[model samples]
Target: MRRLTAHERALWARVAASVKPLPGREVPKLPAVPTPAPAPAPVQPPAKAALAPGLPRRPTAPTTKPKPPHPLGASLDGSWDRQIARGRLAPDRIIDLHGHTVATAHGVLASAIVAGDGARVILVITGKGRPDRPARIRDELMHWLERPDLRPHVASLRNAHPRHGGSGAFYIILRRPK
Candidate 1:
């Protein structure tokens, strides 16, 4: 395990000190943070050879995933949107993608839609991701819905009411299976 810095240790101690233990349980001991290893000696870089005038350098990896592509499927009317936003529309089914990996969520979502049968409204919780981090589930949801497997069942995707998790969740209106 990586060692905690002096500042982190001190802060952890303060927070631990302030918390009350359960009625019969004693305060847990603090984990021992390992000290950082010594830095390696700096190595000099090899001299760079001049490149021919025209070729471009390789592109760097992207730091963040791109936002969802254009909307697809039937766009629900405004009344439907407002019904969801106001919390009046109850979902016939609900699926939570929080804490799941992309592949796992994809499988689960596919299975959910296939099994929904006659269910009309479905609530899917993708979890509002951290401001500092990318929202993998939310970002991938559009792509998932666009897939041929799940696309047929999804009539539309609408943002859930604030009470239902606001931007963290969606209302999946399904097309009635013939």
Candidate 2:
């Protein structure tokens, strides 16, 4: 190769002088950049109603009236007398209104009333008089019959026939509602 001319050599020397010299010691490490924290999530309020169209309004409260007392109590007292005098009621449909528990008796009576308005004859089996005790099934039946709620609905009530249950059971006749 031909030797560089003096002008070309002078240009190369200037370029070499512009470049930085490598450090004698190892290059210093760059400082670490800190990572930014994530932004917090947005909070939302509870919905009182739906945002969609045609949605129904939410209910705020209940809407109903309390029931009134039953009207059957007064009628029960004279039901048998009226039936006997006018032949308005029959005894053949008597049902045995018997149960060991008070709840059962009440349920049976409620169901019987609902079923036919007490037109059907029911023989309630209250059980024989409790020995050595005055509180018997028969007595409880008497108490239930005496309730004001049940009186008006009862057409007639009497002791059961001997073959049916004697004093242990009662024949309850329900009246048809007018």
Candidate 3:
């Protein structure tokens, strides 16, 4: 080996000073690391509340029984007559009249008279005839009465007075005939 110059020796000494050597027993070794596991999914609870009060708990079942039909003529009574005098009738009576057939022209004329004369409580016999075409005429008459022109004549209406046709007829009470 060649002998170093004073400048080269000083440079070598500076480089050697920065470096360190570990003793055999003082050196450290890396420890083994463990991997982490995934978390489980959440669970949901079952339904327990009632849908509505007084209603059946099961959706497939009904809560109440159906009502029986009323006896024939049972719905007709004196109060109905008073209602007729007022030119007003119940929806049930109007529905019943749907069965009768007074001539369209005659019905129109009668409606006109009822309106013009202020006739209170006129009996309209809508016969329970023609099962194939029930209540056709009565329905027509009721429709006609509802027209703006005829409305002035009618005050109120009700099912036929008990003495009247009951379900088969109607009692139309006109506004005091004008």
Candidate 4:
């Protein structure tokens, strides 16, 4: 065994002192952390002053008038017109284009109209478009209806009555299969 040097002896003495437990003393406990207070909410701005001083502010009427159910078609034949007006021309089949992409809607709509089977009037429900993106599917569908592939299958197209779907949907009249 090698004899300890003077410097090594001092280091060992320090280590021995640290390791030795105090006989009568308890270990000191850590202090609790203080939590910070929450920030105050921002105050809202006051309402604008009325136009006139004393006169009560007249309730403003709605800017746009409510549109009546206006049916659109290629010169509706007498009986068909009467039936449509009376809301008696109920759709034999229905297809909703909600949550479908433009490409998907195009393919599905074309296939549905082409394979309309025995249905005379097919109801197409393009949900009243998102407030952010105006009548996208509805406009696309209207344009799609004019294309050669889908056009042959369709005889007439009309805006559905409020009961059916209002401005958001169309009533597609399918041609009789030969």
Q: After superposing candidate 3 on the true structure, give the runs of residues whose Cα lies further than 4 Å from its correct spot.
A: 1-118
Top-lDDT candidate index: 1
Tens digit of lDDT per residue, candidate 2, span 105-151? 67676666556533556666666755675435556665676677776
Instruction: Specify the poorest-scoring 10-residue window by lDDT in model 2.
Output: 27-36
lDDT of 1 by residue, 39-66 (tens): 7999989897777889787788999989
Structure candidate 4, residue pairs in collision: none
Cand. 1 TM to true fold: 0.57
Report the C-alpha lDDT of model 4 over 4-83, residue by residue, as the tens digit.
65556666666665664688976444233334355588778788766777788879889998986433366457798678
Per-residue lDDT of 30-81 in model 3, one digit per residue for the tens? Answer: 2322333455776667777767878876656667888674222234457755
How many pairs collide in each candidate, listed in order? 0, 18, 16, 0
Residue 80 alpha-carbon offset, candidate 1, angstroms:
1.1
Note the Cα lDDT for every prediction shown: 0.84, 0.60, 0.53, 0.78
lDDT of 2 at 51: 58
Q: For all the candidates, what are their Cα RMSDs to the real structure?
A: 18.9, 31.2, 29.5, 23.4
Give the range where candidate 1 is weakest over 10 consecutive residues by summed lDDT: 68-77
Cα displacement (angstroms), candidate 2, residue 165, comes to 1.3
- In lDDT terms, how accurate is model 3? 0.53
